[model samples]
Target: MEETMSTRRRQFKADARQLLDRNFRFYLLLFLPIFIIMIVTAVPQWMNGAGVDNPGYNLLSLLSIISGLLTVGVSFVLIDLQRGVAELTEPVSKSFTIFNRGAYLWGAFALEIITSVFTILWSVLLLVPGIIKGLAYSQAIYIYRDYLDQGHKIGFLEAITLSRKMMDGHKWEYFVMQLSFIGWGIACVLIIPIIWVVPYMNQTMANFYVNLAAQEDESDEEPTVVSPVDDADQSTTESKPETPADGDEKTADNDDKTE
Candidate 1:
């Protein structure tokens, strides 16, 4: 039986929690540098008050963009961890794996720019549309990773386009899945809890992508359909021929009648 979206969402979170429970310390260690990086980039902006009029706002914005780009790497790390493909012994080194590959680095940069521009454009119309569009594009990085895995060198826009398609009929579900982490988000306000919360949230999100991809794979499968003509042809091919005994009996009966 096919699972409903809500059921899958719940399962994704539950599975994530189970995985985290086993490797909570490892994930916490892995997320430490990322949290620190975010704090380093954000603190100055927060202190200075980010605004158009501020002189350092542009610099801070650049830092923020860089930080966001780094998250592309973090996403891969969490995904690898979730999928059990990563080396658990070296979480810190594995976290920077995206930077070692030119494809991942540039692809992430392009995706970030393109999606941000599109989301900002949508926001021009209204806040809700922008949020919705952001949700639609949420899977772009994961889709891009999939394309790379399949050896397809797709452009960033292509990944975003595929994400929009992949997210069809599931944007609200994704949003709700995100909202399910509201308690974790609230806990992060204490700062110390952010290390654990960020990793937990990211792992759950990775699980969400896993579930979404599984559904897409299932949906892409073409069910075998038997046509009436084909079935009839098959039946005719399987029909039994007359046995030698039956042919001999018919000949003997004819001969007997003649006699």
Candidate 2:
């Protein structure tokens, strides 16, 4: 059991290191385009509407909304890339690069957009429900990486189903793990040109999912043993047995003594 746990820790570390190394470039590649797009669309409008006469400040307000929307969308893409990093790195090389860039981006965007709409509505009820829904749908990227990348069309329902199954008995554990990263997140929000919190958060969550998936696989591979009888029956079977020869000899001795 100790050995099993140690091996798991090692695997987790390896996966994490690999994610960090690859994600440095992956997130850069992901965010650059989105950032450029957001800036190009958002900045001018925001600056133009900073006038005091602009009562509603439509441009600034709209730019903020647009920026937020872009951030969320870009985040989904980044998370998707992190989820697929393992598979992406499988074929990495100097001369040849990875593929599925388009599929990964678009699929994540679509799913996230759909789920975000649900989250928007869900968020209306109460803040807690929104957070719960966010966490529940958090595995969308992992689901896409594992299932959808293999040419499978696993839809929203399957994604939720698989995530729930993987999360069973481990939800609070994940929540706590997420909580542990809050400090890192806050620190990132304070720093500039050191933006790693998003990637870190995404990869950490992916790592957690990977761990859970590995556990489920191990459990499925292991065969479980079940006993048909009670402990008393087991004890009886394990007890010493009398030999036929010994029993006969005892009986003969008794008869002779009687004679």
Candidate 3:
């Protein structure tokens, strides 16, 4: 009992340490460049069109749409960063270099495009399918992380399935974890606190995943161990033979002699 408690405590410490050590600066770096790019393209157009009917205002709106599309793609980058931080939090930390920003960005773009089309088509019905698709696709960053290192060979559908599976039973935990950082995110409205906080939260979440992943591995390994009864069965099978033992042979000989 004491040993079990100590092991749990050690696991908690390791998880906490993993979260604390995630490289906040890297995520901040990723968030800023994309943010700056979006702002450069977006704010100017937004500011320039304060009036109701400027001819260029239509153009500005188009630009805004385009910027929004790109921003959607940027989510893939966020996902990649988040997953990277999470993978680092394992009992044994894996080294993470910055991920391929370009591929993730484009993948995000393509996904957004396809989903957008589906959403529009499904607009005839209620919005439930669209919402589910959005959540399903939300894991692209994790998908990219698993695939990018291996030369992009994994089937896209398979990656999606795996991410969804990883998220199973943990979706609520994930939602709460994201909510934990919402306060910091609100602070970013005034300044760039998100640069630090976003990465921090992402890494913290990554740590959570690591802990959960470890628990899952442990659970899987546990059932494989044989119980004492099973061990006894094996012992009996190994030691006893089906062929006539001395008592059985003597009985048979007596029966044969009698016959």
Candidate 4:
């Protein structure tokens, strides 16, 4: 059965909690790449002292893009980890290697560029367009990761295209789903809980992708809906006993009295 989004979300939270309770360390290992990437991405800006008069990341355009791409690559691996393909049972040493795979890494880099360009283009039109586009492109990361993991050669734009299709009629729902996380996000600002929050959020998102994929499969099946009119028509076609006419009944009664 296809679950309502709210039901799926509640299940996702329960799953995340179970994952955390069973092995916090392993989940933390999954989130390590994201934390490291974030710090690395921030360092250059910090060194340049953004508050100063000439404040900006003191890096070449190419390097800055590479940094952003690397962050995206790590994020892809994090998704893979939550999906359990990255091998949770192994040592923490193995956790960091998933993102380093050449195909997933390069694919993420290209996917990030394509989505960002289009998102920025939409933003130029109006803020709402940009937000909607961002939601539309949200699934690209997971699509790319899944493609690479399956040992297929996927083009950069194809993943984004597939994501747009998968997200059709789903953008606003996705937006609201993310909005529901705002409370947890605010809690993460306290620093200590961030480690746990990050992994939980990652796990929830991966589960969401799984649900989305399943829903797509169900849609492809084209489930049938039975209408009331169809039921009435079918009932009328069934065999039934005929009733005696009024004149035939009166004649039979008179004949019985004479006998």
Model 1 per-residue lDDT at 13: 79
Better of 3 and 4 by lDDT: 4
Task: Give Cα distance to truth, residue 251, candidate 2, Å.
Answer: 74
Q: Candidate 3: which stretches are off by over 4 Å? A: 1-30, 45-49, 52-108, 112-125, 190-192, 201-259
lDDT of each: 0.66, 0.49, 0.44, 0.59
User: Tens digits of per-residue lDDT for model 1 on 1-259?
Assistant: 1257678887887887887788887777676667776887667767666543446667767767766766678777777666665667777766676787788888888887778887888788878767877887888877777657544456666676667666777777778878988877886785547777777778888877766665665564321111222233343222211222322211212111110
lDDT of 2: 0.49
- Local accuracy of candidate 2 as per-residue lDDT tens digits, 1-259: 4455446445544565576576567555544544555556655657657852444456655655545444544443434443453233321221111123656545555667766775676678867666565566666555654554344455555565455455555555556666766676667658634345555555555556655655654574321111121221433222211212322311212111100
From the highest TM-score down, the ranking of the candidates is 1, 4, 2, 3
Better of 2 and 4 by TM-score: 4
* Lowest lDDT block of 10, candidate 1: 250-259
Model 4 stretches astray by more than 4 angstroms: 1-3, 36-56, 59-86, 91-99, 221-259
Off by over 4 Å in 2: 1-31, 34-106, 120-125, 189-192, 221-259
Task: Judging by lDDT against the true structure, name the best candidate.
Answer: 1
Candidate RMSDs in Å, in order, are: 19.9, 20.7, 19.3, 20.3
* Deviation in Å, model 3, residue 82 alpha carbon: 8.7
What is the Å distance of residue 236 in model 4 from its true position? 44
Q: Residue 11, candidate 2: how far off, in angstroms?
A: 9.5
Q: Lowest summed-lDDT stretch of 10 residues in model 2?
A: 223-232
* Clash-forming residue pairs, model 3: 86-206
